[model samples]
Target: MLKKLTQSETLAEQAYREIKQAIIEGRFSPGEHLPEEAIASMLGISRTPLKKAIEKLSYEGLVDLRSGKIARVAEYTPNDIENFLQLRVLLEPFNVEQIVRIPISEEKMSELVELVEEQKKAIEDNDLYQFIQLDAEFHLSLAKLNPNQKLQQFIEQLNNNLHRRYLILSKTLEYGSKTAYEEHVSILKALQKGNPEEAGRAMKTHIQNVENRIRGYQASSLH
Candidate 1:
C-alpha cells in the first residue's frame, strides 16, 4: 500500500499527511522538535520524503523550520490564537453567506447534524481528540458546501493553524463540546429555514464562543 501510494503521491505527500496527523492528534506536542531521520524511520520511508513533508507543513504554518535545524510544531501565543480566531470571524461568515445561496442537499445537511451528534458522544465518552476533530469538520463542511475552490483552500489553511490550539483548549474546558453542539444546532436550524442571515449570525457567534472559551482556558492555565 505504501509503495503504491508512493507511485501516485510523492513520498513527501505521504510523509506530510502522517506528520500533520501526528500534530493534529497531539502526538507531536506543540513546540516539539521534528527530527527528519526519526520520522522517516518510524514511517518506514526515506529522509527525502520526510524532508519534503516538513517543508510543506512549514509552508502551511503548522510547523516551524529553523535554518539548518530540525522542524518543530509551531507555538501558539495568545496573540496567535486571537489572530486565528479573528480570521475565522472575518472569512468564514462570508463563506457561509455564499453557501446559503446554493441548494444544499438534505443528506449533506444530515451529515453535519450527525457530526455534531458524534461530538456529543465523544464528549460523553471523554474522548477529547475525536471531539476536536469532528468539531473542525462540522465548521469546514459548512464552508465547503459551496463550490468555491479559493474559499476551501483558505479555510483549510486557517483550520490547520488553529486546530492544535483548539485541542489544547478543549482539554481545559468541560463545556466546550456541549456548547458547540448547541451552536451547531442553531446553525443547522437556520440552514433548514433557508435563512442566510440567521445562519451567518449563528456561525459568527459559534466561532466567537470558541474564542471566548479559549480565552477562559488561557486564563485558568495561567494560575
Candidate 2:
C-alpha cells in the first residue's frame, strides 16, 4: 500500500520523495503513464502537491511531461545512457583534478575511508539501495572537493539524473555492486596517495566501465 505523508512544512517535497522512490523501485515502470489522480488519492494528498512533485521529477529526468499528454516515467535509451556517461567522464575527472590541487584534511580522509568500508558491507549484505546511495555519496564527496559551487551543483544534477539508471542497471547486471565497490576502492587509494592524475584516470576508467556494462546490457536485451 502507498504510504500517506505526515503533515509537514514541505508537503510537496515529501510527495516528491515518495513518488521518486516508487519510480526507482520499479513500482512504476518506464513509459507508463503516472495516474496523477490515483497517486494523489493513494498518498492522501491533493493534486496540487502531486503536480508539484511531478514537476520536480520531470526536472530530474525521471518523469516525462508533454502537451496534451499525461506524465509518464521517463524511458532511457542506450544512446541516452551513453550520452550521460560521456558527460560524467568529462566532468568528473576534472573534479578529481581539482581535488589533487587542494589539500584534503585528515578528518575528511577518514570520513571517506569509513564510507568505503560501509559500502563494502552493503555489498556483502546485497543491499542494493544502500549500496547505490553510498556510491553516489562517494563520488559527490569527491566532487565537493572543488571550490566552485557551480561545478558542485552541476555534478549533483547529473548524479540525480543517473540515480534511477543506476538502480535499474544494478538489478539487471550481476557484477554491478561488486565491480563498483572495487573501482571505488581504486579511486580512493589513488586519492589517498595524493596522485591527482592517477585518481583522475581511475575515475575515468570507472565511468567507462559502467558505460560499457550498460551498453552491453542493452544489446543483450535486444537479442
Candidate 3:
C-alpha cells in the first residue's frame, strides 16, 4: 500500500507548488533573486521547509544557486529554447504515437477539453498569466497519460524551462494568445482522433510559429 503524506510533507508540497506556480507565472522573472527568508515568509512556512521546497525546485532546473549570491530563477537563451523545442518535437510525437494504440479514457479527454476551454476564456479575457498556466497544464497533463513517471518528470522540467520564456515571447507579439488558442484546438482535435502524425505536425507548427514570432520581435527590438 502507498503511504499517505504527513503534515510536514503536505506543508513542503504546498510550498513547492506555490513557489513553482509563482515562478511559472513570471511572478519571479529570470535571474531575479529568490530570497529564502522572503519566500518562507510569503508562504507562511518556516525557512527549513521552504528550503526543502527550493531544493526540489532546483532539482527540477527551475532555480539556480550561485556562490555568495542568492538563488535566482533560471533563464533560457534563444539557443536553449531552440534545443528544448527540438527535443520536445522529437519526444512528444513518439509518445503521442504510442498513445494512438491505446484508448484514452473519457475522463482524461474531458479534462483536457475543459483545459482548452479555460485557455480560450483566458485568451478572450486577455488574462495572459492564466492563459499561460492553463497552456502548460494542458501539455503536462497530456504527457502524464503515458504512465512513465520518469518521462513525465522530464517533460515537466522542459515545460518549466519554456513556460516563462514562452510567456515573454507571447506578450510582445500580435495576437499570440489568440493564435495559441486556435493552435491548441487544432492539436486537441488531432489528439481526439488519435492521429499521431497530424497531432505531431500541429504541435510542431504551433511551436515553430511561436519561435518565429519571438525571433522577429527580438530582432525588431534591436533595430
Q: Which candidate is the best by TM-score?
A: 2
lDDT of each residue in 109-213, candidate 3, tens digit only? 899899999998887787766786788888788788887787787777777766544454334323377887888898889889988788878888877776776
Best-first order by TM-score: 2, 1, 3
TM-score of each: 0.74, 0.84, 0.72
**Candidate 2: segments with Cα more than 4 A from true spot:** 8-10, 162-175
Assess the local accuracy of residue 12 in candidate 3 as a C-alpha lDDT between 0 and 100. 78
Whose lDDT is greatest here? 2
Model 1 misplaced stretches (Cα beyond 4 Å): 1-28, 38-49, 52-56, 163-175
TM-score of candidate 1 on Cα atoms, chains taken together: 0.74
For model 2, what is the alpha-carbon lDDT of residue 164? 51
Q: Which ten residues in a row have the lowest lDDT in candidate 3?
A: 166-175
Question: Each candidate's lDDT (Cα)?
Answer: 0.75, 0.80, 0.73
Clashing residue pairs for model 2: none
Estimate, for each residue in 87-168, the C-alpha lDDT of model 2 and write its tens digit: 8999998898788779787888899999999999987887765676788888889878788889998888788777455545
